[model samples]
Target chain A: MSFLFARDGHLLELGIDGLLAEELSAAERAELDQHLSTCAACQARVDEARALMAQPLPALASHTAETEEIKPPDLEQEWSAANNNRLWVATGVLLAVAAALLVVVLPSGSQPEAFTARGGELSLEVYRQTAGASQLLLDGDGAAPGDTLGFRVRLSEELHFALVGADSNDAVYAIWPPQGGSAAMGPMQAPEQLAAAIQLDATPGIERILAVACDAPFQLSDEQVLSISEAGDAPQVQEGCAQELVRLDKARP
Target chain B: MPPTLDIDQLYRRYGPLVLRRIRGFFRDPAEAEDVLQEVFVRVMESSDSFRGAARPSTWLYSVTTRHCLNRLRDAKRRRELLDEHGTAMGWGASAESAQQPAQLLIKQVWRELDPELLEMAVYYEVDGMSHGQIAELTGVSRRTVGNRLAQLAERAKDIGGGAR
Candidate 1:
């Protein structure tokens, strides 16, 4: 297709007025081509006009200071734990503040005796999946260096666990509970099933862990430490407040 | 006193350019002024740490770009909640840049761009920085910044395409 010469005075006029539709009459097209050959000044004007026309259409101006900045919730408030099952209300806002400071900030020489050390409160929950053995749900209030945590899943009645090491991606540090022990690793095969507290261990730099079995009800008490082991691996241990009672219902397929 | 790097003086020197740039983003002059004022306050607060980094104007551009992006995100969130299409109207028909007319026109046109593209253009065209410097400051790939500038040029051409 022949192009309209932007330098053609007649064409420039038509262009500026938004009259250059997809098709042009033969006479109008002829006029534009002929005008371009003789008019260098018109060519420059067309260029200038084209530049100006490319400017962005004006937009409504936005002001910055007037916009509200959204801040994260106060560092000191406990997040009520509620998920696939029962709701567990931990300490309130005051304790949340203690936890936040304990977890975040560098320790100072003048730190309060109450704030001398940081700790993680561990809990385990079991979830039921229609097509899977178990899903581990982990949450934490605070984490510090030298703190270690793990989720132990028993895949068989023989108590085989596929485990994962903290901070190292793609490493399955699996373990198996000692042979002929009181508890056996079992396949998770039902919805609303319970996940045993296979293991909870705290080493440095580990956060919190919550393991949900495929189907079952579970309980949290202050009295127990759960052991989780994988094949040919030493048993990993966890201690903190015990498992809170929880229930899992299958999500619609 | 180490030659005082008075933010106020810097403001006096560069405020008009920043205002005109910001004015390109919003259709309302009042809002543009508000963004300008916020920029000044932020410069003042952070000036102590500048320690003679890149040219002051380049640093200012980086700061303004981030500030504008954050504001844009916030605007998007508010619009989402209210279920309205967010708009940034343009302004500044009367204010003239202190630069010479041709330069002023270029600078004014610079405002009519998305802040991200405008930032790339200013860094490349005005500040004379290599794409690497821009990538480092903006935390984006150099190739991405280059692509943005190319797109910006095409859009600018289309708008001005019919002008001449």
Candidate 2:
């Protein structure tokens, strides 16, 4: 039993690792060098591995820029009572000037109001559909199982955005862009509903939705979401990026 | 106390080795990258469990192997993998057949084997590790590793025979 790419009982991966780590003996190195010269696939693999090894770690600023504190939404308040027509609006503002200030100052003073002199604002609107009619639900609103939830996003400027969700079970998954990548949206003064809607399962508890808007395409890994959840904090976006946290309590009907 | 290594340091030092091992199992480079990220994410999530490990490389290798095997065990993913790599496997040419028996066996019966046995097969047939090495990595006896691999070989034979 051997590998498809084995040469004289030498495994390609083992040989590559040994060669790269300088762990191979002289004879082993010579043998592997000869084999790699002849095998394009093995050589390509080694090249890719070497390239990956040489890649530099991302700068810390890209990760630690501006994380909002996780303020618990008031669950007892009805959406209609809160917004006066069942409209839940969570807005995030990122000013280039404010972002520059963030490099020196802490994130506390970087609120949307303080930087309103100039910048782009991103807002997320969540709506619950019932009997062919859509009603908006506020953050910390109670939603039951079998409820169909829709989303509409308003962006003051063109940006790449991603919607991610972390459930009470600690399961993190992508919401919008269904796959994992971010979607580019042009500036829209009015709210534009996304084509995709989420159907709530029977799982009960809080479902936290993180809407992130960044000047560049960015991805939030499950590790980051889990870390933020464990810390009970919001995701920290870099300068020229805005993030909004919306929490919905799901209960059994 | 076992030595502790920072997550970033670990990624810097051993990420290539882990990625190479993963790429060996998964044909799709994109899928391999996704799995690589997932493996590290799991490492970050459970860094406490990694504290007392004997060797960081062995731990990471085992983690990467198990992750790739679990992903390959998915019915849909398995179908796609077989379709992608089928030509390069044993059924292709006589020269390829001579070197691809283990790979063909794996592609044939990987779904039937349990997690433990599949891990043993990969360690033995793919990585070319001995029973002792696998036992040391898996914290099992050499005899146990031997027996599980024998069991895996037997299952592969049965599946291969029925397919013929």
Candidate 3:
């Protein structure tokens, strides 16, 4: 009962290695302690393995730009759609230029530079889990690997805010409007927290996540939409709309 | 300028881990990178559903795993498309992401694993969960966790050798 032996009646080296990695906890750690107390061989194994592990792991190769920047087929479709829309706009521009005088229409009080039209405000914050409750991240900071991070969005108007994230590897993701549904809801009266949280793992990279709030639901074609209700699905990004949301950054440990 | 998505910070935090996880799951690291971008796009698409109720890792874990699996399912189509188009015109995948015959052989081996075993392997190997953690997540015993990982490794090796 005291010795941490393999089924073969010898010390389990894997268990010892796991113990050295601090992988064992609770009952396993207690059992490991008992085994270490009496087993000199196991102790030596742990010491040797621990020393070897202390040496730095091999440095990873820097990924190529193409590898980092490439995206899956669906996003390419999304990007192509956005590109097609740009072509249409270009055609419109040609027709407009053909006209002698063009009157631009602007709604009253609508700022030319703002993301929102109807006096809407948008902001994004990252919440990190520490001790017990979640703490807000500041200064475009990041979280440690394995830490739980959640995004909270504050919107002045009840609008749809699409959330998107890009990783250090240059992969762009729709962190909010996963695939099928419309944009996420913003608070009507005040700034509020999002319900889902992100768990940072040992991926050893940073993430930038943002919420783009719009006055109306951002449009995505059915063909463009990936089924978010299913796992591993992505929604198409309407490039123009996605570019218009609020943004934030998280540093990873 | 698009004010919504923060370009610089977005790449900083989630980039490495997402890329790493995607790479771990797929045969080719380049394809993993491509999937990595799609995963982020999916995150945006599901903005409405994600309200910070669950841990973001949990959601991302399944998303990454499932997305890789689904893409693998379409590997045949991808191969045919690649052959027809000769790696041009927005096929989205780079030349490096193209599926090799050996990779396809491995994928066949991967498909033969029990669904539960495959899921557990992904959680442990890619998500970096321990046997105990995987057991808790999957409602299985620690011994079963150990066994499944060994099976996954052995099968992978077996297929890798067979492909050559």
Candidate 4:
């Protein structure tokens, strides 16, 4: 909507929305109408706005189906959004809660190690801390052997993720949201604040944490997970899974 | 006795207009239809409000506009919240082009809109309402509407490619 000046130089907001909705007194409408009588540009604008307003949606029906069934809004979800933030099922909550529980028990020293990796809209940190240390895991310092490591994961909305790890032995582990079909996590941070302990005794050669984010949840096949590390000899992921990798450096034998 | 009113009949007659109006804001047909059904349902369920508000057509027009606006707000958040809460709002294949002029304009800059300006702009420019009409509809002062409209017009010029 735009405004133009009348012959008298008074400001006039053109178009139906402006002119008609103005609740003009008789004299006002007459004045504007008289200006509009000769104003071609203003007339064109009002015509265009009205024409667009009357624009139509194409008729779409599969053999004249009765007013198609509209699945009612999930009122429960709407209620939850307005009242409770306890449900962690959104891809975000799931990713956050799912990524929140990876603990690898590596060696702990005065300063634990952390590694951060960014993968196409997903960024995560893997940091090691002494057991019960108050240090945050997202500081990008890598962890040492026998140290307890936690993860701080930040994810975009509407995406579910799984945190999977594989050691040199090719044994796979579900680091957070631990396997065995466990119950869902309770009201937690949207992008989870997770802490886990990497095993000190576990075989370590670039033990990589692969966090795969997906539009929907599917079984994380062992083969679909590619190598998620910042090292040589990383296993190549062959098939599926969009992932963000966090590599942890373990002491050499 | 006056004949009873059938909600379905009204829907068939006015649903197209409402659907087009709703579709202007959406690319997805199912989303538009969902709002369409919702508009009629509000009228059906609240027949008293429907009758008391104005002529049925006028009431439905206002209701449809309000419903689409409200649903658009919800649709933005549905992505992150619906899967866990229960069945998401069921959407069907849309017959309309997702690339309507207004929809395209919105896609380019919907995020840049301040809530108040966007609301007024959608109603005025997209919905084809006048400032005074919008003031009456939204219960705000007409001056507020003009200021918002002016802000919207200025923003459009800066953004380029908007309802002129």
Candidate 1's C-alpha runs over 4 A off are A1-253, B1-3, B76-133, B136-164
CAPRI quality band, candidate 4: incorrect
Chain A fold similarity by TM-score, each prediction: 0.18, 0.51, 0.38, 0.44
Question: Which structure is stronger by DockQ: 2 or 4?
Answer: 2
Ten residues in sequence with the least summed lDDT for candidate 3 chain B: B89-98
Give per-candidate clash totals.
63, 1, 56, 27
Residue B86 lDDT, candidate 1, scale 0-100: 30
For this target, which candidate reaches the highest lDDT against the unseen true structure?
Answer: 2
A97-209: candidate 3 lDDT, tens digit per residue: 01211111110110010011111266554445443233334322334544455444456545666655443333444445444234645442222334344443333233434
**Which DockQ-derived CAPRI band holds candidate 3?**
incorrect
Q: What is the TM-score of each predicted model, taking all chains together?
A: 0.28, 0.47, 0.27, 0.33
Task: Give the better candidate number (1 or 3) by DockQ.
Answer: 3
Task: Give a tens-digit lDDT track for model 2, residues A1-253.
Answer: 1112342343445446655655566776777678777867567767766786676533222111111112343433321121111112212222111111111000000011000011236767665654423444544455665556656565777889887766555567666666666878757533454655555554556656677889999888887665554223566766678776666666412
**Which wins on DockQ, candidate 1 or candidate 2?**
2
Worst 10 residues of 4 chain B by lDDT: B90-99
Winner on TM-score between 1 and 2 is 2
**DockQ (CA atoms), all models:** 0.03, 0.04, 0.05, 0.03
What DockQ was computed for model 4?
A: 0.03
List each model's interface RMSD: 20.9, 16.8, 18.4, 16.0
**How well does candidate 3 match the true structure in TM-score terms?**
0.27
Model 2 docking category = incorrect
